[model samples]
Target: MAVGELSEKRPTRYEIEDVEAADRRSRWRFRILFAVVWLGLIIGLAVGLALTGRIDPAFILEVGPFILDGTPTTLLICFSSILLACVLATLGALGRLSGNPVLNAIASFYVSLLRGTPLVVQILFWYLALPQFGVVLDALPAGIGALAFNYGAYMTEIFRAGVEAVPRGQQEAARALGMRESEVMRRIVFPQALRIVTPAIGNEFIAMIKDSALVYLLGVREVLWRADVMGTRFFRSTETLLIAAVVYWILTIVLSFFQERLERRMARGDR
Candidate 1:
C-alpha cells in the first residue's frame, strides 16, 4: 500500500481528535435547541391556559409550596421502596434459579401471583383488607410494602437474567478454587450480575417514583394527595393537578439524566 493512501485511510491522531470535537459540538448544539423548544412549548401552554382562565397564576403561587412540601415524602417512599425491592429481587432470583424444587416453586408462585394482580389492588390489600385479618399496617409501611412487593416480582426476572448472563467458565473457575457455592455467588457472580442489571434497576426506580403516587389513594399525603386536598379546598382542581403533574415530570427528567450518566459510567468498563 502507498504511504499516502495508508495515511488517508488511518487518519492522524490530531485529525481524529478534531472529528470527535466536531461531533461533540454538534450534539451539544442539538441538545440546546431541543431544550429551547421544550421550554417554548411549556410557556406557550401556560399562556394559553391563562388566557382561557383555566389556570390562575396567583392560585399557583399560593398552592405550589403546599404541594411541594410533599416532595420529601414522595422521595422517601421511592428510595425506601427501591432499596427493599432490590433485596427481595436478589433473593427471589436465587430462589427461582435454585435446584431445589421447593425454592423454585415458592419463587415462581410469588412472581406469578404478584404479576397477575394489579398494583392498585395490592396497595389496597395491604392498607385495607389486611386489617380485617388483624394484620394491620400503617399507611407509610403499607405503601412501601406494596410498592416493594410489586416491583420485586417484576425485577426478579431482570435479576435472574443478569445472574445467568455471567459466564459459566467463571463460576467453574471459582469452584475449582474451592469456594463454596454461596461464596462463589457472593464473591464472583452477584457483583457482576448487579452491574449487568443496573440499568434495568434504574428504569424500574423511575417507574416506581411515578407509581408511588398511587399511595395517595391510601391518603399518604404525597404530592398528589396534597394537591388533591388543596385543590378540593380551593375548588381549583385544574391548577393544583397541573402543578403536581409538572413536579412529577421534573422529577422524572432529573432522575433520567442521572440514570443516563450512571449508564455511561458503567459502559466505560466494556470499552
Candidate 2:
C-alpha cells in the first residue's frame, strides 16, 4: 500500500520578509521620485536660460569685474554689520534685563521701533535722512548702520532667550559664592548664554548675509546688484545672475559647515 507520505515543509518566512523588503523598495522609489522631480525642474530652468540667450559669454564677461568685486564687498558689509549688531544686541538685552525701569523701557522701545519698520525703509532712511543732520555717511557705512539697526532689534530676542536659558540656580549659585549680580552675569551667565545662543546667532548671520543684498538697492554695488547691472548692460542677465547665485550658494554652504561643526561641539559639551 503506497501510503501518502506526509510532505513536511518548514513554515515560510517569505511573506513577512517580502513585505519588509517591498516596503523598503517603495521608500527608495519615493525618494528617487522626489529627487528626479527636483532634478528635472532644475534642468528645465537651466535649459530655459540657455534658450533665452542668457548663457552668452559676452554677457558673462560684461559684468565680471562687478561680479567678482561685489562678493568681497558684500562679505565685508555683512560681517561688519553683524558684528555691530551683536554688540548692540548684547547691550540692549542687558538693558532689558536690568532692574531700572527707564532702561528697560528704552530697550523695549528700540526693539519695537526697529522690528515695526520695514528693513528697506530703514536702509533708505539711513541713506537719505542722515544727510539732513550734516552727518552724511558713505554708502558702506550707511548700509552697515541700517543692517545693524534692523538686525539688532531681532537679535535682542535671541540674546534675551540665551540669557534666560541659563538655569536660575546658576545665578543663585554665583550669589551664594558672594558674587555680585554684575559679576555673576559677566562670569557665568554670559558665557553660558553665548554657547546656547551660538546656533541662533548663526541663523541671524545667514539672514544678515541675504539681507546684505538690500544694500545694493542703496547703490552699494553688492553681488546681486552687480549681476543686475551686468545683465542689463549686456543682455546676458541669466549668466550673470547664475554666477551670483552660485557665489551666494557657495558662501551659504561654507558658513553652514562651520555652523554644523559648532553645533556638534556645543552638543558634545552638553553630553
Candidate 3:
C-alpha cells in the first residue's frame, strides 16, 4: 500500500478526539431532550387537572407547607426504624447462620412469620392487639417497632448473604493466626460483609422511607396523615394527596441519586 493511502485510511489524533467529543455531545443532547419531554408531560398533566377542577393550585400552596411539616417525623421514623432493623437483622443473620438448632429455628420462624404477613397487620398488632396483653405502646413507638421488626426479617437474608459472600479462606487464615471464631467474625468477617451489604442496606433505607407512610395509619401524624387531615377538612383531597405524593417522589429521587453515588464509590476498587 502507498504511504499516502495508508495515512488517509487511518484517522489522525485530532480526528479521533473530534469523534469522541461529538459522541459525548450527542449523548448530552439526548439526555436534555428526555428531561424536557418529562417536564412537558408533568406540566401538561398539572394543567389538565387544573382545567378539570381536579386539583387546586391555591389549596396546594396553602397546605403544602403544613404537610411538609410532618416530613421530619417521617424521616425520624424511617431513620430510627432502619437503625433498629440493622441491629435485629444482624442478630437474625447470626442466628440463621448458627449451628444451634434453637437459634436457627427462632430466626427461621421469625423471618417466615414476618415476611408471610402484611405489614399493615403487624402495625395494627403492635398498636392495638398488644394492648390486650398489657404491652401497650403509644402510636409512634408502636409504628417504629412494627417497621423495624418487619424490615429486619426481610433484611436478614441480605445480611446472611453478605456474610456468606466473605471468603472462607479469610476466616481460615484468621483461625490459623490463633483467632477465636468470634474474634475472626468481629475482626475479619463482619467488616467486609458490611461493605458488601451497604448497597442493599441503602436500598432498604429508601424503601423504608416510603413504608414509613404506613405509620400514618396509626395517627403518628406523618406526612400522609397530615395530608389526609387537611384534605378532608378543606375538601381538597386530590390536591392534598398530590402534594404528599410529590414529596415522597422527590425523597425517593434524592435518595436514589445518593445511592448511585455510593455504589459507584464502592465499585471503584473493581475498576
Candidate 4:
C-alpha cells in the first residue's frame, strides 16, 4: 500500500480523540435528557393534582405522619412474605426440575394456578374460603400466605432459569468426582444459581413491597389500609391515595438503590 493511502486508512490520534469526545458528550446529553423527563413527569403530576383541587395541603400535613407510621407494618409484611417466597421458590424450582413425575406435576400445577389467578382473589380466598375447609388463618398470616404463594410461583421461573444457566459441564465434573446429584446441587449448583438469581429476587422483593398494599383487602393494617382509613375519616381520599402512592414510590426507589448495590457486589464476586 502507498504510504499516503496507509496514513489515510488509519485515523490520526487527534481524529480518534475527537470521536471519543463527541461520543462522551452525546451520552451525557442523553443522561441529562432522561433525568429531566422523569423530573418533568413528577412535577406534572403534582401540578395536575393541585389544578384538580384533589389535594389539600392542610390534610397532607395533618395526616401524613399517621400514614407514614404504617411504613414499618408495610415493610414487615413485605419482608415476611419475601422470606416465605424464597423458601417456596427454592422448593418449587427443585420440584419442577426433579426426575419424579409427581413432583414435577405438583410444582407445575402450583405455579400455573397461582400465576393464573389474580393475587387479590387469592388473598380473599385465604382470608375467607379456607375457614370452610378448617384452615382458618388470621388476617396477617393469611395475607402473608397469599403474598408468599403468589410471589413464589412467579419467582420459581427465575430460580429455574438461574439453575439452568449454570454450565452443564460443571455438573458433569461434580458427578465425575463421585458427588451424588443431591450433593452436587447442594454444594455446587445452588450457590452459583443463587448469585445469578439474587438480583432478580431483589427486583421481585421491590415489586412485592408494592403488591403488599393488596393485603389491605384482608384488613392487615399496612400502609394502604392506614391511608384508606385516613382518607375515609377526613374525606380526602384523593390526597391520601396520592400520598400513599408517593410513599410507595419513594420506598421502591430506595430499595432499588440497595438492589443495584447488591447486584454490583455479586458481579464483583463473579469476577
CA lDDT, every prediction? Answer: 0.94, 0.88, 0.93, 0.92
Q: Write the per-residue lDDT of candidate 1 for residues 136-232, one digit (tens) a residue.
A: 9999999999999999999998999999999999899999999999999999999999899999999999999899999999999999999999999
Question: What digit string (tens of lDDT, one per residue) describes model 3 on residues 93-148?
Answer: 99999999999999999999999999999999999999999998999999999999
Two-way TM-score contest, 2 vs 4, winner = 4
**TM-score for model 3?**
0.91
Error of 1 at 69 (Å): 0.3
For model 4, how big is the CA root-mean-square deviation?
Answer: 3.6
lDDT of 4 at 43: 94
Q: Give the TM-score of each candidate.
A: 0.89, 0.82, 0.91, 0.88
lDDT of each residue in 11-62, candidate 2, tens digit only: 4545555778999999999999999998999899878877876377665666
Q: Which ten residues in a row have the lowest lDDT in candidate 4?
A: 11-20
lDDT of 3 at 249: 89
Residue ranges of candidate 4 with Cα displaced over 4 Å: 1-23
Model 2: residues >4 Å from true position, as ranges? 1-45, 51-54
Winning model by lDDT:
1
Pick the winner on TM-score between candidates 1 and 4.
Answer: 1
List all candidate RMSDs to the true structure.
3.5, 7.2, 3.4, 3.6
Clashes of 2: 0
Query: Residue 60 in model 3: shift from native, Å?
Result: 1.4
Candidate 4, residues 1-271: lDDT per residue as tens digits? 4755755798576655577799999999999999999999989988987898767898899999988988999999999999999999999999999999999999999999999999999999999999999999999999999999999999998999999999999899999999998999999999999988999999999999899999998888888999999999978898899889989999999999999998998888754
**Whole-structure CA lDDT of model 2:** 0.88
